[model samples]
Every structure is written in C-alpha cells, then in structure tokens.
Target: MIIELDMSSDTPIYVQLRNQIVKGIGKGEIQPGEKLPTVRQLAADAGVNTMTVNKTYQILKNEGYIRTDRRLGAFVSENINMNAEFRDKLESELELLSAEASITGMNREDFLKLCDEVYSKMKSSPIQIST
Candidate 1:
C-alpha cells in the first residue's frame, strides 16, 4: 500500500500515516502478519522525517494494530482485540461524525445509509495469519 501525506493539511503527518495504515489493514490491502516498511524506509518513501514514521508506528503498536520485533521490525497484528475501550473510542468518534452530519442538514436516514455504505466497502472476510 502506498502512503500519501498531505503536507499542508492540519492533521499531523504521524496521524495521517497511522490512519492510512489502519485503513489499509481494514481493506485487506495490508494483510495480517504482512511486514511493514522500516521507519527509515517509510520515512524516505513518504518524504517525511524518520521521527514521524516512528511516532506513527508507536501509535499503531499501542493501538494493537501492529507488533514489533527487534530482529523483524514491524508487522501487522494477526489478532486484533476489539475490547470495551475500543468500543468507547468508536462511539466517541461516531458521535462527533453524527453531530457533524446533523449540523450539515443530513437526515437520520441519509446519515445511516452513508454509514452502511462505508462499513460495507471497508468490511472484509476474516483473515487468518500464518506465523
């Protein structure tokens, strides 16, 4: 998967990188146990600083999206845990998006339809990772 960064966007470079990686995993473009580029390699490819990639990797690790090994570097996690904490985070983000849709004059039905479309598009069959 290619990582694209918008230098002018208000979002931080690390956040953008993290989001893209997560989206890639969700879309199955980056499969579980797939190796990720090293911090320096990704930095060079994305034209961002190594620190930015490192930060993104750290965040992904903390969020259980990736795992790191001293010898192997980073790879997508085989099993992702969606515990209560994650559910709360998802709820918070959805609440904000729902509010925005309401403020933009999107009716409840339309908003739900849009949500369903996105969920369907991103959903993938269960992936089994080989060690």
Candidate 2:
C-alpha cells in the first residue's frame, strides 16, 4: 500500500502515517502478521525523518495494531483486541463526528447511511445491522 502524506495539512506527519497504516489494515491491504518496512526504509520512502516513523510505529504498537520483535522487526498483529479502551475511544470520536454532522445540516438517516457506506467499504464480510 502506498503511504501518502499531505505536507501542508494541519495534521502531523506521524499521525498521518499512523492513520494510513491503520486504514490499510482495516481495508485488508495489509494482512495480519504481514511484515512492515523498517523505520529507516519507511522514513526514506515517505520522505520523513526516522524519528517520525518510529513514533508512528510506537503508537501503532501501543494501540495493538502492530507488534515488534527485535530480531524480525515489526509486523501486523495477528489478533486485534476491541477492548474497553478502544471502544471508549471509538465512542468519543463518533460522538464528535456525529455532532459535526448534525451541525452541518445532516439528518439522522443521511448521517447513518453515510456511516454505513464507509463501514461497509472497509469490511470484507457483509455487515449486519440490528435494530
């Protein structure tokens, strides 16, 4: 997967890198246990500093999205846990986004449809919605 960074955007380079990697994993572009490029290699490829790449990897590791081994380097985590911390984080983010959508004149149905569309695109299996 190609890592694209917007230099002019307000988002930090490391955050952008982290988000892209997370999205790649969600989209199944990067498989579980798949090896990722080394920090030096990714830094060179992304035209960022090694420290920035290192920071991104550290964040991913803390989030349980990736794991690192001294001998084999970093790879995607075989199992991702959707524990309380992640759920809380997800809830907080969605609450903010939902408020933004409401303020921007999006109705409940439209907002939910948009959410479903994006979610469906990311998951390989069919989505089951419960009322």
Candidate 3:
C-alpha cells in the first residue's frame, strides 16, 4: 500500500501517517499479520524523520492495531474492539466532519437528509468480495 504525505497540512506528520495507516486497514488493503515497512524506510519515503514513523507506530501499537517484534518488525494486529470506544471515536470524527460541512454552509437538516440518502443508497449496494 502507498501513502502520501501533505507537508502543507496543519496536522502533524506522525498523526497523518497513523491516520493513513488506519484508513488503509479500514479499506481492507492492509490485513491482519501484514508486515509494515521499516520505520526508517517509511520515513525516507514520506520525507520525514525516522522519529515520526516510530511515533506513529507507537500510536498504532497502543490502539491495538499493530504490534512490533524485535526481528520480524511491525505487523497488523488482531483482536480489535468493535464497541463503545470505537463508537465514541467515530462520533468525534463525525463532529469534525460536521464542522467542516457547516463551514461550507451545509445546514443540519440538509446534512441529515444527505446522510439518509447516502445510507439508503449504501443499503441497496451489495459488497462483492474477490477471491
């Protein structure tokens, strides 16, 4: 999987790396037991300090999304939570999204209506997994 960093973003590089990794995992591109590139390698690719990659890896480890082995390196972890913590985190993310939407002049009702429409369409669409 490839990830690109935007130096222009206000968010810190480590946070951006962590967020992108999470997104890759969520999109099913990165699977459990998948080995991540070395921290130095990722940092070089991202054009950031090795410390940034280490920091991001630490966050992912704390979140139970990945674990590092001395010789094997970092790998995607199993046994994740599908509970209140996730719901709360998702809500926090939605709040930021809503704020951005509001800034772009999307009213609450319009946002809700749009959400319903999207949900309806999503419900109608079936996911097809490739073998």
Provide the global lDDT of candidate 2 against the true structure: 0.92
Worst 10 residues of 2 by lDDT: 122-131
Clashes by residue pair, model 1: none
TM-scores for every candidate against the unseen true structure: 0.93, 0.93, 0.74
Q: What shift in Å separates residue 19 of candidate 3 from its native position after superposition?
A: 0.9
How many pairs of residues collide in each model?
Answer: 0, 0, 0
Q: Write out the backbone clash pairs for model 3.
A: none
lDDT of each: 0.92, 0.92, 0.82
lDDT (10s digit) by residue, model 2, range 93-121? 99999999999999999999999999876
Consecutive 10-residue window with the lowest summed lDDT within model 1 = 122-131
Candidate 1: tens digits of C-alpha lDDT, residues 41-125: 9999999999999999999999899999989999999898787778789899999999999999999999999989888877566
Q: Residue 90 lDDT in model 3?
A: 73
- How many backbone clashes are present in model 1? 0
Candidate 2 clash pair list: none
TM-score between model 2 and native: 0.93
Model 1 TM-score is 0.93
The residue ranges of model 1 lying beyond 4 angstroms of the native Cα positions read 126-131
TM-score of 3: 0.74
